[model samples]
Target: MLSEGQRIAGQYTVERYLGRGAFAEVYRVRHRFLGRQAMKVFKHVGSRAAAEELLEEAVLLSRIGHPNIVRVFDAGIAETPGGRSAFFTMEYVPAGNLEQYWAARGDRFTRIGEAVDLLIQICDGLAVAHGERPPIVHRDLTPQNVLVGFDDDGRPRVRVSDFGLAKRTDAFTGLASARGTLAFKSPEALRYRKGDSPAGDVWAVGAIAYLLLTDTLPFHDDSSPVAFFGVPRDAPPPSPQIRNPEVDDELARTVLHALEPNPARRAADAAELARLLRGWRNPETRQ
Candidate 1:
């Protein structure tokens, strides 16, 4: 097997394992011609039909192009090192996922305005995905799947990643086959509710907003780690000000609204949420 720093496909050099999901493994790689990029190699699909499904996801991501979404540049079930596994190449942001970025900060979110700006961009991107003709629901939206990088102004730029479990809301009418981080999951998701719609992604964005402002997750793992894994959550509204009181109330309220137990009460979609953050002013200070 190719280890860290080894080259695969005779052109791309693997930097390291960035992460692994249920269906695949992600690697930080530098393409000889493309430079730095991320490569997601799926485990053998086990059947021709399954392989077609994985390739379809690649096609779905390629067709749904958005600025804040990770761009998939190349994809094929090429035969090379590591055998006949399927893989797709995408842009690699050096900053890694939001979780690592937050942890490196000593569990503190910096530059309130910058963090909000990042969240707004994410909202716009997700909105584009959800607004597709039939709508696309990112069944799994969490810090681990969201990436953060810096802009020319050194501002934070957020990107959504990992679509292995994504689905078309217009066609899917049953409980999501995929689940994300327990704490960031929507209440309906906990209930195995059917329908993969924009609402679940809204709830996820809300959880991320809360995490970016506060170091802790809105849902607590009070039980033993093993037990907690199975324990259902009654997520509470997390106070961003608990760690940094500097967070604006309007911003905090927006986050809380996204996380409300009643999915029906959540923001309609990413666009609505983005509108709330547009020209954001500290509502608490305005009065």
Candidate 2:
């Protein structure tokens, strides 16, 4: 817990506590020269090894430079009241996560065009990750990890954050280790315990698209203990049109295509998905 007036790493002066997560506590901080930024301080107190591990994540963030990915400014080991801690500063996103942004819009249905636009931005960011030499897979892709920022025109923009679960496709790891949140897992991912892949991320993008338009999960069911296991093998998920009639058939079909059970049948990658979304015809008045 950083105090409001405390300074760390010889530069950042804590302004206020922002929020806490399972592994870190975020704070709003002011740099002596860099102005305002968000500081993510690891919570594993007194563990030099833990701090070192977090430094690796910071390095990864720094390497993955994209307009839609949160930017890392600085990171290092810092002395704290509790002990030495690892902290990183990132570009602060003011509008909060996509989950909060969606909720703030109330129960009214989001415009289909607008929802697709947001998904396109997300895919654009992930495509950059996938475009890397070995390809980076953002295993965790959910509303909670998406930050809604704003453009110079005050229009809502989005950036992907929380890369703690990201992994390079070529890196050797346990087959099951590359998974993310259960609800966003692809059917094949859940069944085979496979780690991150382009197909897996494409599935997540489809799920997020479904969520934005319908305000519900694609495989919605509460009775089953395992969400993926409950998916009907005899039939595909209910079409987005079933939940929100306003969704165009082509748009619904495109999103559902990304959620195909077979990885081979899914969208090739985030770039492909983004291209598909970009093709949707504008429903409102044309420019």
Candidate 3:
């Protein structure tokens, strides 16, 4: 583990530890000249083959450049007495992730309009990835992967992060099989049938919207830590309005539409979903 105050690549000065997952450890660091940043370094050091696999994440981040996506400032191999480790520096989102943002808000649900706007922001980022030549599908789309921050104007901003599970649409079969958190996965993904599609990502968007509105997952399987592990959420979940009466029918309908099990029937893509959210109107507020 890289300790606080450790310097990597002779440029970034480690400020403190941020997070750690099975594959990597993230540190909050300050570049000698670039200010504050988040640095992610692979945990394991072994075969050159393993290093290449881990480097793919940095490559993906470098390729997908969008304001709504986490920006990769630099990437390189760091040499230490132990060995060489691959690392990348990205924008440091101080507000943490969507999951943390939502949890801190207490029992009160985020305003319907605010939640819809946040979802639209997420869709904007997804649209960029889905628009690529071969289309990059983020097999994993959870609140944990959505970073929340503030812009220069001090307004809330969102950026999609963690592309480790992302892959080109054409190669989905080989890479995305049985990936992603079970709760956020589309039914098709759960069934391991064409699991990495724009439609599958759309489903995750719906699940996120549902969670934001109700503070509950669309489907849950208490029998296992993995929600809906083997059980398909064949039945449509009760409307988000059931939990938060403030969730109007228009918003509830949009969310449920995205959760549709049939990929063909869901929103055409993230762009389409964004449009729906943008067009949503509260009839009660009509003039």
RMSD per prediction, one decimal?
A: 3.7, 3.2, 3.0
Candidate 3 per-residue lDDT over residues 1-287, each given as its tens digit: 68788889889888999898767889999999989999988877766676667888888878878888999998877864457777889999999999998787676575777778789889999999888867788988999999999889977788999888888876434224547777788877776545768888899999999989988988877346343443556656899999999987888888999998777788968988888888784445333
In candidate 3, how many Å is residue 118 off? Answer: 0.9
Tens digit of per-residue lDDT, candidate 2, span 1-287: 78989989889899999888778889999999989999999878667887888877678788988888889999888987778889899999878999999888775475677787789899999999888877888888999999998999987888898887787786554123456787787776665566458778998889898888888887765235665553452245789899899888789888888877777778978999888888775534222
Output the number of the TM-score-best candidate.
3
Q: For model 1, what is the error of residue 194's alpha carbon versus the real structure, in angstroms, after optimal superposition?
A: 2.0
Highest lDDT model number: 3
Off by over 4 Å in 2: 46-49, 107-110, 171-176, 221-225, 228-235, 281-287
lDDT of each: 0.74, 0.81, 0.82
* Prediction 3 global C-alpha lDDT: 0.82
Look at candidate 2 and tell me the lDDT of residue 31: 95
Compared with the true structure, what per-residue lDDT tens digits does model 1 show for residues 168-232?
76454523443655666676765554534678788888878887787667766633463233334
Alpha carbon lDDT at 97, candidate 1: 87
Which 10-residue window in model 3 sums to the lowest lDDT?
222-231
TM-scores for candidates 1 onward, in order: 0.84, 0.90, 0.91
List candidate 3 segments past 4 Å from native: 80-82, 171-176, 222-230, 281-287
> What is the full ranking by lDDT, best candidate first?
3, 2, 1
For model 1 the TM-score comes to 0.84
